[model samples]
Target chain A: MQASEFSRWTEENAVYAVPKTIIRVGQGERSTAIEGAVTEDFLIRTLKDLIEQGR
Target chain B: MSPLSDRDRQTLREMFRDLKYPVHLQLFVEDGNQGSDNAKVLVREVVRVMPDLLRLDVFERSRDSLLAALYGVWEVPTLILCDQKREDSGIRFIGLPSGYEFAALIEALLDVSQNRIRLSEKSLNFIRNVEDDIILDVFVAPT
Candidate 1:
């Protein structure tokens, strides 16, 4: 999906990069994001941290 | 005329050869939306190449309001990939999957068709144990 086509989403999410990844927890009320490509370990760790924080 | 080249179709056929299960693609579209139209064409062409492995169902957003809401689809040109049981895999491409995003779409289809998630055992375990809903919205550009 191209960010240009989703202008509103890009603007709201601040998607200024190629691979901006948003980790949205639950109904998108709480979330975290990464601006670039990340390793599986890093992503998993981030997810774990977010899960812990939410808990 | 097809948007994909003959070579592209051949490559997709080869890539889809390993698909052992069914992948259902639910595409939500609205009339007169250029992005929606493009997504419809691209998705149909991609699924055409792998009919044995892929199932595509196109829907009008306004006409299928209940289904759209059920699937949590609130946008035009939202392509949702599902497993054999028609269960959503949480993989969605919100616009036409073009350029680099096209490759990601192919990979996602393959993954869903094969029921394969390329995460480590520990990561998989953690995900499986998590009770809360997790959504990964990957924002990408054509370049």
Candidate 2:
């Protein structure tokens, strides 16, 4: 996800708060982690990066 | 008579001995409540395992009003997790912490005792930047 997409989505949604930290734990094929403290900016950035990665 | 069998009680007693911080399990029972007996039994079983971090404090309502209000316990079998410093973070369980929720209860207890939640780097980054007060209320069933 690119930075811009992350910003736009978070700004538009009021109910969904962006996470302060987005940790992708684990490694290789079976990696998993949890997101915490969602703030406005973090949500936008995360979404953008996700979209860019096509995830 | 204790609800737990002799074997189970012994195992619990050993588990609690290894804890680094003290734990308290305050069980609030209302007269004639359906699960009061069950709750008491569960507390006894838990105390037997982690006696160091686990304590069973029973409140009969008539004993003290201030204690109930302090814990915000309106119902029976409420579990409040406190840190090592004796600070209450306001994390509460309204019903029995069994089943999938039991895992959550264990994790929360560990977090309070250790003062840390193991997360990935990316997740940690997001969490560290959060300035706002975030209230996470997770609901689950005992079964």
Candidate 3:
């Protein structure tokens, strides 16, 4: 949540360097189904799980 | 616009330390769109956290490029995983990864990075031996 807390967590647990990309989609567009906004908590949790499993 | 909090970035950096294969994220965006700015911010934030394990590439496709459809990237926030050998096994999401879809995105990334899909052994065998490029399109809502 807070920037400081997030920064501290990142500093301690970072292990290996893996390549990743984040694609941002616009809302209310017609071509695809990204109809609304996505929250930060959701993305962080998802990414954390994905990375943890790697270890 | 920042997609990852500080803690999330740290966790990702730690997880990436064990990665055997490289992860590449290609961001598809349309110019002159309001959402593009937010998308850019998210992309930048992710990169800031795990610079080694993640890289973001932006492609501004023309109407023809977008319509012609190579990789079935119909949306801006679509993520594709490429193995070490430069082979593509299509894993796609139709919306921004938030809520349940956020977890899905991470799972997809792990699957791609590890080159291990959760499919049964039979399905895994089927996918491994196949020579042709396999394109998979998954559609989901942010619940």
* Strongest candidate by lDDT: 1
TM-score for all models, in order of appearance: 0.82, 0.53, 0.55
User: Which residue runs does candidate 2 get wrong by more than 4 Å?
Assistant: A1-55, B1-18, B118-135, B139-143
Angstrom error at residue A16, model 2:
16
Position B69, candidate 1: lDDT: 97
Quote the positional error of residue A42 for candidate 2 in Å: 5.0
Q: Report per-prediction Cα RMSD to one decimal.
A: 2.9, 12.4, 15.5
Candidate 2 lDDT over B1-143, as tens digits, reads: 65557885675455434466766656677666656666666666666567667666787754656888887777666767766666774567666665555556666666666666555677668667654333332122234
Could you give candidate 2's per-residue lDDT for residues A1-55 as a string of tens digits? 1226434744543224333233322222222222444565654465444433433
Top candidate (DockQ)? 1
The residue ranges of model 1 lying beyond 4 angstroms of the native Cα positions read A1-37, B135-143
Report the TM-score of candidate 1, chain A only: 0.76
Give the better candidate number (2 or 3) by DockQ.
2
Candidate 3 matches the true fold with a TM-score of 0.55
DockQ of predicted candidate 1: 0.60
Superposed Cα deviation of residue B111, candidate 3 (Å): 1.7
